[model samples]
Target: MTIAYDWLALGAAACWAVTGLISAPQSRHLGAFAFTRWRMGLVFLALAPVAWLSGGLQQLSLVQLGILVLSGLVGIFIGDTALFASMNRLGPRRTGVLFATHAFFSAVLGFLFLDERMGAQALVGGVLIVAGVMTAIAWGARKDESHAFESLQGHWPTGVALGLLAALCQAGGSFIAKPVMAAGVDPMAAMVVRVGVTCLAHLLLLWSGVGLARAQGTMTPRVLGLVLLSGAIGMGLGMSLILLALRHGEVGMVGILSSVSPVLVLPLLWLTMGRAPARGAWWGAAMTVGGTVLVLLRSHS
Candidate 1:
């Protein structure tokens, strides 16, 4: 069962990698706030009916519902908006590396708040995984690489700050949700609440006439399609998997497994951009795989 949860986390990582790839251009086009708003709206539309039919919403107590709402606001609303904002400035690869710090944040928070402790082997594996992700992204791009995805868009410091904030909020959100999930809240129902609250928040922000909340580029059919696709896969499916993993898995372990998104994104970038990653990327990927094996083996044992 632990191994199964590990796989679920890995699956979520894969989904998020794809989402990051699909989101880069659209995020730049729509602006981070607008893109997040639109994506959350779409995710809410898609998940609401399913959650209703499943009748999972009724299982939550008022306190649990409140906690879930807060998780949504922090995780989906703020964390996601910050993530894409960072991506717009730093590009997906660098942003991903910074975002990978969430694993450590989650581990620490789990220890402090949830009293979750990892074995020595698992801790070492987590360290290696994070090191590999940072290595792969920090040195991933070639010197002469001129692809838009490799180019920095705005102030690098601002991008870095946003990335770290996103990571922290992500960890915080998971910490908040862990208890509710462990109490046997349906994953889909929990997701609907989180996403629905986030969608409402975004709508409120947009309605407030904030210029930053407005779309930066004209919305086209192609962009809308990409938004819907990324939202469905990343927020809808990916997040649901995370919730499921949290149902039985420790937050630290789930976070460590899911933080492999940066490593996973490498191959997808290679496929989409038609260029092989650097030697450092391969080495880092190898380390990431070894670390993942260690973690999984620890779980099995």
Candidate 2:
């Protein structure tokens, strides 16, 4: 708890950034539904080992199990579903930027449930994040014609609606996770339950609605491998780290730090794709960093 929550949050953000960038290449070959399914499935497969290794499973209680599953359904299942949909609807750049909105939701959630006070730094940081998004995304563009970010504001209604949904689901998922674990659940065990439940949620969605199943791109062995990468990097390690950090720290800080994904992905996009982000991306980075720095300085007060 003594360490800055923002640090762990940043780690989560950076990890997620890498996860998205890594997943993007392979994701191109797969449809969003199929891609997300495999990605989440891999997470469930890996959770068994992680849970056992962490020794969190030994004492897994009913309440803990319940909370974990709920976390999965809400956080991984619903939150990520919305997230990936956003990626399809809006590309990674804009999605990442909009996804940063999770900070506001987390802040509100923290205030309500965790009784965590938002310092002046947190407030100012939140405003800066908004400013950054507005500055960067007001007219952001994506190279990928199919990606939603290309015309996000042009179809302002759809993009804003989906982003808000993703933000809410993620925020709710984060809010529910802490108290459950803090009530004495081990973080690793909690993750296993969440991932497993999330997997089921996807499965159920696929079955319940033909539209979801039909939405998928063809799933072949090659595509499956990429999904595995997504699970390993994006869900398994990244999510586990998030659970650990949230268990030990406040969600507000996590939210603030998590906002870094938009900024973190820029360099990677440039390096890997030989493409610089739209000018809006750079401005977003500055504001996100500035807001994050506000958290750092204020946490000292």
RMSD of each: 1.0, 3.1
Error of 2 at 256 (Å): 1.5
lDDT against the true structure, each candidate = 0.93, 0.71
Compose the digit string of candidate 2's lDDT tens values, residues 175-254. 88888755667666787787777777667878887585444456778767767876777676677667777866778767
lDDT of 2: 0.71
Kindly report which residue stretches of model 1 are placed more than 4 angstroms away from their true locations once superposed: 299-301
How far residue 296's Cα lies from its native spot in candidate 1, in Å, is: 0.5
Instruction: Kindly list the per-residue Cα lDDT of model 1 for residues 1-301, writing each as its tens digit.
Output: 8989999999999999999999999999999999999999888898899888888988789999999999999998999999999999999999999899999999999898889888888888888898899889988888998999999988999999999999999999999999999999999999999999988988898899999999999999999999999999998889999999999999998999999999999999999889999989988888889889989989444
Among all windows of ten consecutive residues in candidate 2, which has the lowest summed lDDT?
Answer: 145-154
79 Cα displacement, candidate 2 (Å): 1.1
